[model samples]
Target: MSAELRDRFFALSTGGAPADEVARYLAEVDAVDTEPAATLDGLGISWHPTVRFKAVRFVDAERIDADVRELFARPSQEAPYLAAVFVDPRELSFRTFENIVPLDRLLADTPLDLDLTRRAELAEGAYSFSLRLPAAARGHLERLDALNLYVPPLNSGSRGGERFIFHSAQLAEALTKAVAKALPQPLRDGFSHVNPVFRCNRFEPGDANFHRHRDTPYYDAERHHVSRYTLLLYLTGGSATPALDLTGGVALAEIEPFTCVIFDQRYEHEGAPYDDGRKVFLRTELIFTFTESEVTHDPEIGALFGKACYWTGESVFAPELARHADAYYNQVAAAHWSALTPGADREPFVHKQFRGVHFVANGYDFWFAKSDKLSLAECAAITLLDYFNCKLGDTSFRALCQSEVIEADEADAAAWIPGFLQDKRGDSAVPPIDKSLLFPEPEEANNECCPFHSWAAFDATRSEDVIELYTQAQTFAKAHILPAPIVMLGEDVLLDPDKFVIRGNSIHVLGKESLTPVNFAACWNAGGLPGNYIDIAATVDTAHFLVPPIFFTESDDCYHLRFDFFRNSWMVKHQQVTIPVPMVQDGVCDDGDPYPWRYAVDEVSLFTDNASDRGKADLWWVDNPAVEDEMRDVFD
Candidate 1:
């Protein structure tokens, strides 16, 4: 009987059973089971013994249906949607029940600054302050890696009083595991992780109350995850009123401390103003990713191709390219062409073999000879015609060539006809082609080579050949194509000479300059004095200094230069060794003055000794001679 109950409990816990059903079943298990706590713990339920699960169904059917339809329309597979679930706290019937850890104990060592001056002001009269804490505070929770605490900048309609937001990976993981235990098998399988960032709202009596508003879905690009539901963990209790007042006369009034309310983000809800006492609650999001198997079943080739193209220019491309490359290639190669779809316009194709050829036209235009110019597109089309003819060995190629879409220019068509006809007829007497006639060297002014030029020369017969061509194209691009020049600013100021007059004491930035990783590394290893710039010198008024090479790291949002002097030895000894990039924020340095005017610095100006020195004029020894002697004594 006990074994049967265990199986049923496990089935209900993981099988996406309704919360009410699971809750009722837990009661039954508790009544009959000898070790109910052990059984529940073994199944991954981490809630306190006093907590009882309850489903809070909203009355707004229209809104719920709309949300469901929207989720269904998403390209990725959808997870189960629960309108709301109320985790009610009940008096413990059993003896020696384990109690939840006190919130004060959990936040004992955490430093709190209640100053609202520096905090970001929100809608209504609400304001907040935040702090970042290590995950170690919540001991035993392995998934909580880091915590970021801040008050959320709520949307216009929503308003709340002073709230401290806690974004903790540990809390997210703990909640995720607990939630997963109650989810159906399909949803459990699709569950990725809970959003680490959760809002901790503290609304005192007479504080700004939240107005009715729908939550916008939170998207995490880094995780490729989205929040479908909002989880509210009520931290403080004693109020008779429900914390959340929803649309359509429904109210979630379970004001018991530790009672969690999980609801869909689509629900229009508001925190009703309470004058009786304070209300504190933790609000977090349940995040999930689309299953790979589902996404792969009917992949969106166009979107994937677009993403792949964007990734090509990004610093981090390898992982992203690898993800979509195979799937995109497979879809495109297997696609059959009958007619051109709407929005079929001339654009560069992602694939190398199809470069220059109209990607849209390739879908419906069966004919090889369409355009008049003997350009790269024409060459590629002709090559494709020959490849298909050779591979299939039939009249199909000829039939396609004579299709209704064929709009050949008689003069241009005649140029490649002889060689094409010779190949088709298996004729050996085809003369050695004058390569210059077909592909003349472009003028020096227009000599910018396409990264995929090499691939155009080689005919791709199979997917492997296409892959090899892509590899070659990447190699060519890395070798020949220089990325857009990184603009290194001297300080926070713009360095356009036309916009800002070049002053006598200011550093004059020339045009943009590109720095390869090799150049940057060499400069850093050689202690800011690269071999190429040994003879170069820059002068500011009467002072002269060797131009320091600038280095920076790139992220998804912005670029940053490390300002740590210990990492760069030259910076320690020379006051002039500094890359004056824009400061991320306005701040007063130790000297009790605002930062200097930021300006752009050109690499050539620095290397050619044209850039002015704007650093401190006094020597380090003059300011701190005793420190120099102490450093020498320590070293000696």
Candidate 2:
């Protein structure tokens, strides 16, 4: 009797019969055989021999509690039972049928223009589209108690599909009741909801083939719920050529239409290729949430899990960094709390906190130091607290946490104040200090180059000076220095400065004018600020600075500013009068070397072929005319 029913069902499914006809035949098979697994075996539907199987007809949600209990009663090494088939397609109503069938038709009719150049980059020949189900369809699925079986809408696209997420209270209750018994002791009572999102796939038989892969767990946008299991439902089935192949040599041939397979996402599986027919499936996930106690095993420690807040620049860091910071803080907090427990695992906690400190320190050093938006002292304090908490042993850490006072010498701030300022002034040529060195690491006690000891010694003798220098250094680093200005004569012609010399009041800039642009053309000069002169001098002498303006006649465009060597003034446009050199000069240093002077030019006018456009041949100015007054004041 089972063999006859199976043959009739297969013929109806593969012979282009309506889905309702195949569904009606399966309902008839369900009427004769009460056992789902026995019916499947009798009908020749194969599954993994080692995998445990249980089936619940979609219409019989009331009986799920008893069935789930019976399935989990047997001893199983796997945390969750392998697979559960939601059988009997009779529950797929006409409304659900209308929502699904038209999507396949739309996908077929839509014209897809595949980029031939990117053929290798495409995912096989199957195209994917992100779509949402119609409001009416969602309402009908809810009314039919078929929310779990809802299919998303289909549209035309090139590759990769989008996830559709929707909430259904009825589906959540059914899933919770079904998997409640199988959850671990801690997670049994914490059942949250079935993942509302559906991962839909449409595979055309000669074009679509999925390689052997394991699905990763899904986390919701907020990360409050995570999926441990994958729910796969086949809406249409044809062609036995491509079987559902599992890791254990189990190949399910001709999986009946509307058969929903629930399995662990960790299971490795693939779809074999077929020469004919198409397969469409919708994949959803079962999501669960863990409370603070369940996650950290302690209520007090769990309180800190999601509470730590860190500052991050939206433009500077990746968007995911904020989420990662929350997770890392929770992990580190849990480890720290666990270490404080009596007779708890100490080494692992210490190691975790140590690594976490480095992460926090590096993040601040590389990113936050440049912006100076986050407080470095606060970051250092947080890291120091973690270090002391983990390495100081349970008793001492506990005492410190309870606010017990520890004796320590207080250094006099006045002692190192003068010397620190003098050292900073003397060492103005030193390179920029790495801000991360301010973070102390006591673990590397034996390493001579470790910054912890150096920092500690500085703290004792010159802490105030270090703080002052750090503030100034951070400010200095944030200043924006402009690049050398470009002088363009018409579109393609460029005035490239080869050499610049200042004598008295006139500044002479000598360079070649090229019709074709040169790779490097800017006139660079040795420049530095008083505070950072030493550091700047250590590398290249040239610094980015503004050039002074040069006024020239159309007939004498080649004549540039001439610097008077004796009078320290500038002669402009061959004028006999000398303009006092506009330069800010610092007095001679202790070593007798004069500090670099700074000046700027407002505009450098040149006669160009198209200078007549502005109605003046000699009035053509450089790119930036806004600084003309400032440049003129240098000579004034």
Instruction: Give each model's whole-structure lDDT.
Output: 0.31, 0.30
- The residue-by-residue lDDT of candidate 2 on 456-530, one tens digit each, is 432211233323322332232222111111121111111113233434433344322211101111122332223
CA deviation > 4 Å runs, candidate 1: 1-158, 184-189, 220-224, 240-242, 291-636
Candidate 2, residue 579: Cα displacement in angstroms equals 52
Candidate 1 TM-score, C-alpha based = 0.30
The clash numbers for all candidates, in the given order, read 12, 16
Report the error of model 2 at residue 15, Å: 26
lDDT for predicted candidate 1 compared with the true structure:
0.31
lDDT of 1 by residue, 312-344 (tens): 221021233332333332333222111212221
Query: Which candidate wins on TM-score?
Result: 1
